[model samples]
Target: MTTEQHIRHRADGSIDTAFYTSQGRTRRSEAAHSMARGVIGPLVILFSFGTLVALLV
Candidate 1:
């Protein structure tokens, strides 16, 4: 039950966050991209819907 063992035992796969060079980017970059998309996608939709509603009013 040590820290390293606990981290390595996640339900997902390996806990190591190191990125493979074959992928051409680090895991940190991937996580950032995912987070940006998650935030931006909703914001864009909300803005478009609001603009449409405003035009109708």
Candidate 2:
């Protein structure tokens, strides 16, 4: 059995490192925003509840 190795070549005959790096950075930014929202959403909910309770009392 012969093993085959996959090779990638860009149209310009140069390595497309920048394109892959940019994609990775974009994904990382998206993950960070998702995490921030997860934390901030709950805090906002709690704050609103506290404010309403205080006003009623």
Model 2 misplaced regions, further than 4 Å: 1-12
List, residue by residue over 1-57, the lDDT tens digit for candidate 1.
656534433356765454434344666689899999999999999999999999999
- TM, every model: 0.54, 0.75
> Which candidate achieves the best lDDT against the true structure?
2
How much lDDT does each candidate structure score?
0.74, 0.90
Residues 1-57 of candidate 2: C-alpha lDDT, one tens digit per residue? 999975455798887787778888999999999999999999999999999999999
Per model, state how many residue pairs clash: 0, 0
Global Cα RMSD, each model? 8.2, 3.5
Residue ranges of candidate 1 with Cα displaced over 4 Å? 1-25
